[model samples]
Target: MIFLLLSIICSVTVGVLLKLAKRYQINVMQAVTWNYLFAIGLSLFFFKPDFSSVSFSLISPVYIALGILLPIIFLFQGFAVRQAGLAKTDIAQRLSLLISLCAAYFIFNENFDRLKYVGIIFGFVAIVLTMYKKQTSSNNKYSWLYLLLVFAGFGVIDILFKLVSQLNEIPYTTALFVIFCISFVLSLAYILYLAIAKKTKIQLINFVCGCILGLFNFGNILFYLKAHRAMAENPSTVFAAMNIGVIIIGSLIGILVFKERLSKWNYTGLVFALIAIVLITLSKLHAV
Candidate 1:
């Protein structure tokens, strides 16, 4: 339970940090690039993932896909937080489970209960409502696209992760480490290109911000995995608690601390998101 609490805090903190980045004039791309460096360091220190047994040929495609997607989606998330606010951005991220659910049904041939179906329907509705903005400015309209991309990007990443987990030749930790390394190299290459071609000067503050982001990002994954291990018998509990806790906590912080405005429809969407998650959890429990 304590691990679950810590995981929730760390997850929400990532969004909070992204939100604060704009105020501090942090370069998100540079910060994200450095983030993978610190994440790789932490992964090596803690997981110590063994790669000797891994068949690189067998895992390369999925690994490369994940490596390409991780940093890109992370950047999208940062932009989404800056544009859409933490409350909606978090909800969009969590609702990405809907996409994964569909993939399970079609690609993986997994079955879902009626509750899950209803939940998926509600999840779509929530996405549409939560992304709704009152402003009619072209910039505001364009900004909301980031939220859509966040929703879709995380979904594809989730599906790819599931594919990685299914491969028996590679350990999950090893796969994670490799993906992080790949993301780091790609991000660094892009940053260097910007430096040389666009004359974008890298700053120390961005590195500092990235390191902090890396800590919370790694902490979130560590504690969530620990919580799952701690409650191995009740997997649905961990799933439900993680999603609900983040949505609730992130929304509170966005609205109260940041004073992010939300319409009546958006508030209703939040409630629907909660209900959808509960239903999906119930479906999982029923399957068990």
Candidate 2:
């Protein structure tokens, strides 16, 4: 669907922008903090989320958790791409589907046929291969932690979003607004702390970059949710499409646009990623 395609493009664009930010010497932390500001503004202006419809009596804990978690993981992602490479960080984030798929089976009690089983198992091999590199930084000893955090953080966030979506009482836009508002508060506080305590100067370029990032970031979520709603009966279809598209585009951008190198093992992992997506999607089709 067009929605899924747009979501994938927006997601990859965000990664590419972050990668470019490092080279441009932009203040990523400041930009990210302000990104929440612009995202909140965009949500209010376009979505115009109804707050009166939301009540504490029917509050979802998932929303509360995401408010803080979203910004924290966002910062981790920036760190991941900057410290590791774009392709590596992109794979880590996209591979989060592995965790979500496992959760769906064990925790959510979703059924998976043999095809899904094969796909899930193959994803692990892809992850190990993706992490392999010919020559990493001397900082490789601990730097991988950033990429690992991005992987786990996004998985947990996806789980929380699913939980929120399942609740019929909570309007999705309202929940999103609440989450963004909390993220804005936390991010703004951090920015203020840096200004007062660390004396880090906030630059206009940060807000400029934040505005651009916010448009794509908001579009990513908007289109993703729309795609899911359009294909509600077959979520795996959207999931497979989104992950595969990001992995493919992200890899291409990193390799061609950014001139980032990947080892043979990494390329092998990418091939496995495509296979996993096919198998997973086929399992959904078979179920249907």
Candidate 3:
């Protein structure tokens, strides 16, 4: 429970930092690139994942793909924070569980329980309501397209992580390390592309901000995994708490600290999200 709370805090902090980056007109791409660099180092120092047993043929493809995908989605997340603000972005990210739920039922051959079906229905409604933005004139209206991209990209990422986890021959930590390494290289490629095009130069401020991001980002995953292990008897609890906690805390931060205004419809959508999550957890009650 403690681990889960810490994980939620770290998750919200990542978004907050990205949101704050807007004040300095921080180069989000550069910050994300440095985020990967530092993330790889932290993974090495803390996890020390051994690569000796890695079967490249079986594991390499997935890790390489994740390497590309993670950084890309992270860039989307940065854009969403700046474009959509923290509240909607966080809800969209959490709503990705609905996609994963569908994948699990269709591709993974999981039983489609009644509660989860209702949860799925509620999830769709939640997406529409949470993304509702009243007419505005700041020319800063939330980009629903970007928010949807965040939703789909994260859902795909989660499904891929499930695949990697099922491959018991490869150590989970080792696979994570390889993915981080690949993400680092991919991000660096993007940075170099910018430099060659005379688009922008790397700045120290990016790294300064990125280092803070790296610590909390890594902490989020670390604490989440720990929470799962700690609550192995109730894996569904971890899943529900992690998603719902992020929503509740993230919304509070956005509303209270950032002073982002959410419409009544958006508030209604958050209520629906909670109900959807509860239904999903109820569905898993018997399975675990």
- RMSD (Å) of each candidate, 1 decimal: 1.2, 1.7, 1.5
Write candidate 2's Cα lDDT for 128-162 as tens digits: 88877645457655547887898899999989988
- Backbone clash pairs for candidate 3 read none
Q: Which stretches of candidate 1 lie over 4 Å from their true place?
A: 54-58
Cα displacement (angstroms), candidate 1, residue 252, comes to 0.3
lDDT of each: 0.92, 0.86, 0.88
For candidate 3, the lDDT comes to: 0.88
Model 2 segments more than 4 A misplaced: 56-59, 134-136, 139-141, 230-234
* Best-to-worst lDDT order: 1, 3, 2
TM-score of each: 0.97, 0.94, 0.96
lDDT of 3 by residue, 42-92 (tens): 998988888787656756676787889998998889888887789889999
Task: Give the number of the best model, judged by lDDT.
Answer: 1
Kindly list the per-residue Cα lDDT of model 1 for residues 1-288, writing each as its tens digit.
999999999999999999999999999999999999999999999999897866657566988999999899899999899888999999999999899999999999999889999999999999989998887665556657899998999899989988888877778888889999999999999999999999999999999999999999999989998999999999889989999999999999999999999999999999999999999999999999
